[model samples]
Target chain A: MSFFKVEHLTMKFGGLMAVSDLSLTAKEGDLIGLIGPNGAGKTTVFNMITGRLLPTEGKIYFRGKDITGTQSHIINAGGIARTFQNIRLFNDLTVLENVMIGYHGRLRSSFWEAIFRLPRYKSEEKKMRSMAGELLAEVQLDNVADEKAGTLAYGQQRKLEIARALATNPRLLLLDEPVAGMNPRETGDMMDFINSIREAYGLAIILIEHDMRFVMGLCEHLIVLDHGVTIATGLPVEIQNNPQVIEAYLGEPEGA
Target chain B: MSERHRREWIYKLCTYGAIVGLFAFFLQVQNQADEYQIRILNVSAVFVTLAVSYNLINGVAGQFSLGPNAFMAVGAYTTALLTLSPAEKELSFIIEPIIWPLSVLHLPFLPSLLIGGAFAALLGFIMAFPVFRVRGDYLAIVTLGFGEVIRVVANNVQSITNGPLGLKGLSEYTNLWWSWGVAVFTVFCVTRLVKSSFGRAMQAIREDEVAAAAMGINVFRHKMLAFVVHAFFAGMAGGLMAHLITTISPTLFSFFLTFNLLVIIVIGGLGSMTGSIIAAIIITHAGEWLRAVEEPMAIGPFNIPGIPGMRMVVFSIMLILVMIFARQGLMGRREFSWKWFCGFLKIGKRRG
Candidate 1:
């Protein structure tokens, strides 16, 4: 059995299928790329995997345990954290505060302990704050730690979202369009940051990226989906040459 | 924390010390000006309690409750029914049956007051339990309905509340002591609660309910916890009100009274307990001070007519202006913290 596996996942919004009978297996420490053109249902797969949406018909197994229709918080607590395609961060909160909030679920301090100013609660809060700062610094966002998240530039906001998800201490992290609106320079910088965080944190990552070069460079394995159906799943080279995958992307436009 | 923030902290400390000192001065009966002076102090203390408790629900917990007076009524009736003597109660025809069974409740004044408070708090918890599942405007409407339902029951249940005629002639045990003590205790509890992890959870819910829940904060549990705690203090304040006036009527505890408490908190600051405390003192004393201006005025060598209800008109305008300019209340969302200042100076607890 794979570390994470999805079988026969089908989700329908009315008569239109958002995801259709998709099945895949992700082994431990796999850096997988999920790619397709616009409306390829890449994010829908991430949502289903993260338990943000339930499969109309399917089973999801994480580390050999079936996890279907679980709450997002619980799934996150169970070692899966995800960012949205649009960067859904708590924008009003300060950058550091946003990251600290991500650790709120994991902090182990009793209510009475905090009220009484127990040494343990005091030290734990301090440690968590320091850890949040470290995470922000990892993404080179330390300078804007005190600023409201909404005040950050677009690229910085994307980095902060990734840092916040990392604060949850997940075994599996999903990045939806991690570099959607970045210049080539920022795109390269973000690609580097993602690879470094994965190696340092020892966490498996599933990424959605439209930039073919960036995705191909980082992903050890690849899956191609078009119109809510998986057309190819193999090594990067195998996926790049698959005629069915070619037709799906080719069907939408012309040539190649 | 900026230099301005440091100075503001020192100013706040001095103001608190002065306020406590002033109250201590009032406690000395020898310093009393007259019957009216003592009465004003008593009213200030009650307002302080109500305003602080209101902050617990509205500011720290972020529940927009408009039901303070209803809880107050519950406390007043409970205290009256528990402590009044049978013969004395019969003279009033108000709450004879309830007190007739509680001869043991005649054990001193303070204990009876506490028993009444406990019952009122229990009633508050019962009322808040079901409504905690919802949020925002829906919860507000449910609580408003709860307040009305309590009032209707008080009106029609002649055997209990005396049916709009109201229970009266109970013992007048409130003075500078019970009122001021509860006021001080309310400030203490509210301050402590806001500093707790539970308080942090509540504020998180206020900041962003979805993120707070994703952080496993148990949003509904904390909301209910705050609601019950707020009800407990509101009920206690109500009991004090009944004793201060030495009379009771359903008309006294109405939605209008809730609106007045709302004004008190709004004028101070929403989330700041200190703001609420300061605002309470101002509103209470200011109402008394208004009478002198509103009453008949005699100028030197001339007579001037005083306009009644003019003060309320002025107060309404002041509320509107405050909302426009200082909408976060007097304190914004931050509590008064000396340590945060030290952190900013790079000398104390490290801040992110």
Candidate 2:
């Protein structure tokens, strides 16, 4: 059975349709990619799935339960995490604390318990710190954990964002433009890290990327959108050869 | 030992030892200091607590709330009624409450402060339900309206607040130990909060609220907690102030009080708790020192006559200068850590 399902999802912003009648599924261990040209509403789809934006007409089922219209907190608690297209992080905080925010939702301490520094709360806080440290190590960002998150290079900030998402212990992770501003070498390293994380954690991922090269190799399933409409859906190989996908990408490149 | 382990241990030792030393020092000064200086120190400490708490909400969490005066008024009135003298209790009946009194509660200083803080926090939480609905200029206006409404209500309630006369002749026993103890506690609490995951979430909301919520920060709830916590401190400050002045008046907790606190935090730094405290101390000391300058300047062989309002005029000029030259106030949203302190001694810092 699919770990998460999005059926007939539609989102409208005032008079404009942001996500029009889209349906998709992410099963256990599935790696899906949702791609479109700029302004094709790709980020809106991620927003809807992560409960940042509610779909006007749709059902989202996570683990066989209806999660449609659920709040972002509940959705996160249900094992969904996302990174932003523009690398949104707590800039003033240290890198380690940014990842710690992701671990807060699953924290078992009551507010008073944390305040009083109960034995359990103290243990949990220590655990969370090391877990955040491990996640930083996983993303190969252990060196910059003490620096302000905003002071890091753009590529490192992107890695920090993904590390924060992973800290949520998510079953289904959504990454938006994960390698948008990276060098070719850094991009290659990010790809390897993402792929290894998927295998190690058994995570299903929905990737939204502008880079065709990485998305094609990373994603097993590709869903293409054009101006809020899903114009094409298939495996990456089929998508690369589809006429509509080419047209949506403003006609195929001459060499490709 | 791990580096973080050593750092954590040192932090704990300093904070705990500092807290105890602070109370001890204040207790020693209980009889030595003049009453007026003691009173002013007490007042400054109260504002110190208020400013730090306000920093938690506006500076750390990025919610601009101008309702500290309102919360303070609530606390003052609550304490006034709870700890009123027999004559004051008789007057309290003339000004009836929204609800019937269980009995004439004559509480001591600490219990009264706690109850007042809790009561003020309740009002703050209620106010936050709507205050946080808006941001920026709109939030400022709404919170200002809350403060005004509170003053208006207190003014209209003749039986309770004594109308324009206010509550007179309170026991007035607030001391340096109590005031600074709360101030130290406030700073400790906010500092610890900023160091924790919850504090990170608050700064996240301040930095990018939408992303914070997506990351499971619960922006609204966090904002409310910060607001209530700030209001709680403001109420404690109010209880201290009410006792210091011994006479409670609606005019006592006015927009003036709000602006003074705002000026302290703003001049300090928008998001710096440490800056807020340092700024509060400077402002308080400046107010005290300005008295020395209120008299006309006496240069060599020239007798400068005292100008009654010259102190205020000179203080205003200093405020403008601070704004223009050092817009970030003293600390500029940065905490004073051992590294920052030791950074002054560059070689020492590098060695350890």
- Highest TM-score model number: 2
Least accurate 10 contiguous residues by lDDT in model 2 chain B: B95-104
Question: Per-model C-alpha lDDT, please?
Answer: 0.80, 0.84
Prediction 1: B-chain TM-score:
0.84
lDDT of 2 by residue, A1-256 (tens): 5678889989899999888989998789899999999888899888887777878998889999898877887788788899998888888888999899888877777655665577887898999999999888877899999999999999888889988888888898999999997878888988998999999899999999988999997889999998899999998999998998888777766788
Please provide the root mean square deviation of candidate 2 (C-alpha atoms, Å). Answer: 3.3
User: TM-score of each candidate?
Assistant: 0.81, 0.92
CAPRI grade, predicted model 2: medium
Against the true two-chain complex, what DockQ does each candidate achieve?
0.35, 0.53
* lDDT per residue (tens digit) for residues B1-352 in model 2: 6997898788778767877887777777777878777766787898899899988888888888888999999988888777775555575545564334624557788898989899999998888887888988899899999999999998887766677678787887777877888898888777766666667778888998877777776778888878888888888888888887888889888898888888889888888887898889888878888898876777999998987877668767877987999987777887777655555779776888
TM-score of chain B of each: 0.84, 0.90
Runs off by more than 4 Å, candidate 1:
A10-17, A36-56, A64-66, A86-94, A107-109, A133-153, A223-232, A237-256, B1-23, B28-30, B85-96, B99-129, B292-310, B338-352
Clash-forming residue pairs, model 2: B94-B159, B95-B159, B95-B160, B296-B305, B296-B306
Q: Report the Cα lDDT for residue B294, model 2.
A: 74
What is model 2's DockQ versus the real complex?
A: 0.53
